[model samples]
Target: LIITIFYSTDNPLNKSAITVPQRAVSTFDQQDLSINMHILKWKVTLEMIKDKPLFGSGIGTFKINYLDYQADFLQKNPGYIKYSGKAAEAHNEYLQMLAELGIPGFLVFLSIIFVFYSLALKYLKNKHNNQNRLIVFGLLMGITCFLIHCLFTFPFHVPVLGSTFFIFLGLSVVYIGGFGLSKVDTKKNIRIKLNLNYLIKKIIIILMFIVGIFLIYTLVFKPYFAEIHYFKGIKYYEKGNYNDALKDFKHAVWLAPYNGRILHALGSTYYHLDIQDEAQETLQRTKYYFNDRNIFRNLGLSYKQSGNYQEAEKEFKQAIYLDPNFTKAYIDLAYLYATQEDYDKAIIEWNKILEIEPNFSEKYNVLYFIGLTYQKKQMPDKALEYFLEALQLTPEGSPIIEEIEKEIYNIYKDRLNK
Candidate 1:
């Protein structure tokens, strides 16, 4: 399995043979493509670690925190083209733990692996009976394989597999005298005594309980509740309850102040509420955590809505600079130009959108807009051609179908009159 995994054309095995220019066009297989994404993920993790070195980004936050640190170059990379969704987990368990739980957590995880191997080896060497020895060897090999696989995949994320793995892990621990403690020897008259330093033990226990509670609340519970509130805000927003959405968004933001999504949502809710200044200020907070094109696009929209055309233009252009194929940015820019009566520039922007997005989902809408732009330019012939093309692209029952057909008929009528 290891040989097959690494020797494939897409994996890093061929990385050394490719020239600098060749690297650009080099195709990575699905597995290797994932590894390429992991490189980006690793960079994000490193940046996240810088901010929260002790506790890292907190539990269950790698996905939530990933986009903020995405490098602009990754947007242009072919390897990342189809890897559209958020990277929820680092494929590598060690790196995932390092990013989410911080250095101390990472070290503790390594210690667990160490203990597993140590006990496995001890059992393998000491077991005399052939059956028991073979069983021990198999368990050792199974664990070794599992750990090796965990290096490149998040097997533990799968519920059934993860449960089974832990079951085996528990069995291993039980077989090895439980929780790193040696088995008590009853035959030897050995008096095992606890070092009873009562006051000191009580203080230590209290301190541990306090620390555990704090860690659980800060890392686990708070983030979970924040996500819940963020989702609630989305639900409210979808129902057109802007005030409730605003309240939930604010609560989410308060809970997860460093969360980019929550902040972005809060800012968007503020914009929906027509509180432009607050929208801008709230969105600005996300800049500290996220360098995403979507966030920039939203920022541009906020500025555009506030009538700050220059800043809006700048933000939209920045979004394009970050992601050359960002169709939404192009559309927004085109509309912005159109609003300013720069029909020529608007048409040019609309054409650029076609150049980048041939298979755009809303192709008919885009064509219809191009037709409208041409009509505004007094080019009836060009307008008619695009309107006809849009008619073909439009779904049969779509409301826009009648509008497009009507425009086509009107253009032809005018031409006949001329």
Candidate 2:
């Protein structure tokens, strides 16, 4: 039975590589596209609007306008045509909405962000209670991270993310707005009812009761349901039954929509299922519940798999922007540029990684790629330098190390013999 269980579990791992062939293909094919393409799209969209900041383009017109603008842009910058195929969306939902939905959508979006931040800040600032302050801080950071990430990717544009965010916003508004005000009113009532010492004692007793109830609810009641659904989702996810996993995850989310971890798991499962759109949407929903960089990285990768390179790069950059020490984004961005044969950009990204992480010894692969790029650029000396650097970084006895050493020797010998 143990053997059977192990085999059954391993089946998903074995078949995972083949489950989404099209997505894999798209990831490989579009991995190396330039980030400039996304920037160009943004620039063209802005230019077409004649610098108007208030009124946006119109609903559903961002994609159309992006394409129209790209055509004009390509005429001026012919190099873009070789890399880009379709006239994609503005890669930025805010900018896209600003262009398409005009001023109304922008204001609505900004207003929502403002409300979330305001309530979170209010709770954090005035709340003397430690527990309430922690919750408020979590919500504040979550919303802030989401908004900052949105500057790059359009996850909020998706219904799942928008709905989830609004739900959290509503919950926050209620929790902070109601509870804080109620506490003040309760204090006033207590003062009116008794002497100062008695009122203080009464408040302490009430707070203690509430804390006890919360502890009981969290420790005894909440775990039973949350654990059951969480495990059920994990089982489905492990078995490669993504539909079942998604249902279970959705149930978990429904039970506790404020749980960021659950939302991230659901979003990741959706991504593995090749439901890129759904994955993007679900992951976006997680912003209200938690602040996890993994979600941003996965969301970016999902967009990349969906042939949305512009959006993918944006998310990757957002991840980096959020935590400059996030090494994965640097590697992914490097891989992205390398795949597109934009070796210069790849080298730039890799160099940035080295700058941020000087001791990142695993960057031999990046060094090798830098060598390859120099070779492509027909700069033999530069290529040789990087090849030597790669050789130095490689493990002493590894086959890859030996191979790199051999290549460096050959390159040097050939150059000297010339």
By summed lDDT, which 10 consecutive residues of candidate 2 come out lowest? Answer: 16-25
lDDT of 2 by residue, 297-412 (tens): 99999988898888888888866654455788988887777777787888888888777677786878778877877877778789889888888788777677766777678787
- List candidate 2 stretches off by more than 4 Å: 1-224, 231-248, 397-399, 402-418
Model 1: how far is 333 from its true place, Å? 2.6
Q: Please report the TM-score between candidate 2 and the true structure.
A: 0.44
Overall local distance difference test of candidate 2 = 0.73
Q: What does the lDDT read for residue 201 in candidate 2?
A: 90
Indicate the TM-score of model 1. 0.68
Residue 166 displacement in candidate 2 (angstroms): 32
- Candidate 1 C-alpha lDDT tens digits along 278-332: 9889888887765567777888899999899899999898777656668999999
Model 1 poorest ten-residue lDDT run: 19-28
Can you give the TM-score per candidate against the true fold? 0.68, 0.44
- Please list the residue runs of candidate 1 whose C-alpha ends up more than 4 Å from where it truly belongs after superposition: 1-71, 74-85, 94-119, 131-135, 156-221, 290-293, 317-326, 355-357, 409-418
For residue 277, give model 1's deviation from the true position in Å. Answer: 1.8
